[model samples]
Target: MQLHELEVENYRAVRRARLSFGHTTVLIGENDSGKSSLLEALVRVLDGGAAEEPPNFESFQFHRDPVKHEIVGPIRIRIVFREREAGEWAGEVYAPIHDLLLRAGEDCREVAFELRAQPEGEVVWRLKSGKRKTSDPEVLRWLREFTPAIHLRAGMLTGYGTETLPCAPGLCRTGETELDEKIAAIEVAAERLISKTSPNQESDLEAGFKATRELLQLVTLPRDRKAPNLARRVREILGKGIDLNSSQPTLPGSNTSSEKLGILLLIAALLRVARGAMAKEMEPIWIIEDPEAHLHPKSLASISYFLSDIRWQKIITTYSGAMVGSMPLSNVRRLTRRRGVVTEHRVDVTQLSGVELRRIGYHLGAHRGAACFARMWLLVEGESEMWMLPQLARLCGYEFGVEGIECVEFAQSGLAPMIRVAEQLGIGWHVLADGDKAGQTYIDTIRRTVATKDRQGRFTLLNEPDIEHCFYKHGYAKVYQEHARLGGKSTRDMDPRRVIQRAVQTLSKPDLALRVIEAVAADGSPGVPDVLQKMIRTCVKVARSQSK
Candidate 1:
């Protein structure tokens, strides 16, 4: 069951925003964007408060100074649940959900929720102020009186170091219960493998016998079939009577300490799995904060796949693009915060090109395979190129990734952050840049990044200040392959070299030489020179609209 959509009003940094979330949503943004704030609100509203508990609003950052005298206001959280019948997504639109539902509505399905605030900033999730003496709100009264659910920590995995977990006992790395479960499962798995080698039971007899005995002992039952002579009879059957008496065995084994720790870790995992089984409602949406933190690349990859299977609608937060790229494209959520109110967006990778392509490349590599991926990287100036160049590479039909050809738009602010992230990712990179003089500075910055590579293989810098120039320089042989659908021949003669000439000819802002370049590159068809010239004028109008 999914909390298909959210409508929050005047809650924390989010004053009023309505959003639709996929079953598995990856909530991402720079720091202090309302990602966490949004989750907290949902958890509280979903919790269906039992007793009066005031929401702590101290941490909420406001875009405006709320009236000091105000209180007793309404903060509404509306979650829509979708019902799917057979292959189609059906519907029974409920206001507030009682619990998570896979296909909408409780099995006995009843849904209505209402919450109100108090004058002193002590928001009463249920209802009432004695002076007002009104009856409890109908919606809140029903939910509070009849059905309710446990509000999970929006992020159960918040702190990186603390071992405490929310699900169950022995879930912590050092928990004992987890260890026992692991030891049992491991024995089962290992013996299953061992049984393969010893089809006749000669090689695995002792181990299998031990496992059977231990498993029996774990549940405090007797596997020996003899009640009185428990230890003695069991030991004799395994042919280890002497060692049993000595309280030690002579056998190849993993260290007890290591195995014990491993068991605890195993149990912790099992407990989390069990949490779903035990939930009173639908399987929970596991909210995670940087699940990639402090884990090995291989482990992170495995975990990434596991998380993808969680099936619970999720909201994963991260500061690292590695985690972002490791995630599927459909799940790439980009939360944008402006002024003080926070909003969300899906990073539509399809619209990105050139530099944006590289950013995504870094994101994919960093998220999936390595926390620390390729070194020295190229930082592009825009997101569009990052979005499309993989298409460019595909058009050229060159297989890209395996050859270590990774690139990403560093960030549009400047080449500085891009270079820094590359340095952090430990990859040396060459940059393809715009033709303007300022771009030279970006080029110099990138050249310095690969200062260490063997001088010959040092850095591969490819520049065409603009793709048009790139089109201009490499037009003959590859142009057809790159923009294959281009119906016309190259219009190199009409190409504008300087920003000023194109600006003067095109009534548009002559200031942006790049616009003229874009116009020429838009078409490669014959007799398209008129369109190219017109494109310059169109681009100028576009620039004017943008400035306005």
Candidate 2:
């Protein structure tokens, strides 16, 4: 089962906040806008692994964290999620977080954690640091089993520890490889640069910076900060070039290809070993943070697909909304904090209207790019209807939040698939389809398709247009008759009105009144209220005339 949402308190930059999580949630904001802090909280909440007992913000990528700036004391992190059931949302699904971590700060009490789970649901939380007087066994079990663990931060670059190059002779320009004097010689050049230009102590500054620049050009990776792994690889390679005599592929270039290929092989081999090492019983919560550290967009795209293919649940956090946009919307939510409160702007990725869908495609360099895993589907009868619905929904305070909703031409596939997908992700699904001919057919289909005994059902199929029309959208004969008598612009759009009137003709006054109110509200205009006032008077007069 997938862990579906999160909440937090006093966690680094977030003094008090809550977040709505999707399966593949993209936490987007300006750097240090509490994005990484929330991620750290997730790590602590799910896996209970915070390095510093008191939670140091600087070490976890919060450059300007108030705490890191030494302004605040110890902090806390809380995460909450429900598990996914195979068929329905009956009561609650179970996905318990295991392991609890807390670091004592200079200012706060010993962090306390109490875990509670029931047939209803489970909740895990820790109090301000208190250094428990006595340990709770249930809490201990919760920490051991439920907490989700994240093994790697997305910034890795080397095969081994950063100090490997410096320690091994001939590994750089001079001589460092323990195996060969050639590696030891290569180490000399790297050491020369490290001594001259190292950002940190005992490292080559010029060599590291040059390697960083070269990697960025090669992979389009952001160079906000330098890393030791990429730097060491660069110096050793430039010092000795590719050892084609020993290398099998016979690379085409000496400038970067060989080194790049070598690093790729190292990472690939390591990943395989790592994947294999994972226990068959251990279902890890894989969080790949900004995976584009050393690959092209195309390659990154493939990597995303690979991650999606994994059988276990994975929550990938990315800076690129476009990448998330390519995934399912049922798994997306915007992370924003206001007044020190984190509010999740939860939106279905398929919330994009027809126009927004076209615009996104344009921005992505394809008129209709189908390559991305996530897509937004637009459901409408015709182009004219699709054009007007978004405007209407917006005027009524419904902004689909514009991420990845696709506009499809038909309702059968669009409606059913949309609801089914949302059910799987445990996201809300609302069906607002056209109220025209065969409209009832679509509604009935949705009802029967998703109608189950499960509590908290995900699909909501609204019969939105019923109260507005005088007749159902079908019944052409009645529509033409009403159109001729009313002298409308045309009778084509009037058939459904006739059908609705006939359907409710024998109903009581209260029933008719309820339908009338629905119609007026749906017209969605200030003038509509006035228009409804007149339509009621007309209906009353017509009823009296029929009585006479």
Top-lDDT structure, candidate number: 1
Per residue, candidate 2 scores C-alpha lDDT tens digits across 359-380 of 4334332322221222223344
| TM-score between candidate 2 and the true structure | 0.37
Residue 277, candidate 1: C-alpha displacement in angstroms: 7.5
**Candidate 1 vs. true structure, TM-score:** 0.43
Give lDDT tens digits, candidate 1, residues 96-125.
Answer: 332322333334221223344433454544
Summing lDDT over every window of 10 consecutive residues in candidate 1, give the lowest-scoring window. 233-242
Best by TM-score: 1
